[model samples]
Target: MTKADLIESVYLKTGFSKKESAEIVELVFDLIKTTLEKGEKIKIAGFGNFVVKEKDSRRGRNPQTGDEIEISSRRILTFKPSQVLKGAINDSNA
Candidate 1:
């Protein structure tokens, strides 16, 4: 869901004003972004973990042209869901 949808959910669940809900959601997102920017990880009790991983520059080949290219180094964010979350998702699908 989009940010607005999340804000709406917060509003409905918490009985918060729309403006207040938006502010709360924005603040939570900003905190997550700032933490990730520092290359740290976040772990929620039953949700999952958010990790930042770094990759070094590497050599790659072009698919069609058969030419070698250098892949740039970068940092990536990844999420690993907790077992509880995985079970919930599987149960819902079933």
Candidate 2:
């Protein structure tokens, strides 16, 4: 779902004002962003883990020109869902 959808859900569940729900959603996102920027990981029980991983510069080929290019080093964010979450998803599908 989109951010607006999430905000609405929170507002409905908590009986918070629209403005308050928006702020709450935005604050949660901002916290996640800031934590990732610090190269830290967040683990939410029965949900998932958010981690930042660093990759070294590497050589890559350009698909268009078939030229070798240097790929700059970068930090990437990854999410790994917890076993409980996985089970819930699988059960729903089944």
> What is the alpha-carbon lDDT of model 2 when measured against the actual structure?
0.98
Global Cα lDDT for candidate 1: 0.98
Q: What's the residue-level lDDT of 67 in candidate 1?
A: 100
In the range 11-67, model 2's lDDT, one tens digit per residue, is: 999999999999999999999999999999999999999999999999999999999
lDDT tens digits, residues 1-94, model 1? 9999999999999999999999999999999999999999999978999999999999999999999999999999999999999999999999
lDDT of 2 at 49: 100
For model 2, how big is the CA root-mean-square deviation?
A: 0.7
* Each model's Cα RMSD: 0.8, 0.7
What TM-score do all the candidates reach, one by one?
0.95, 0.96
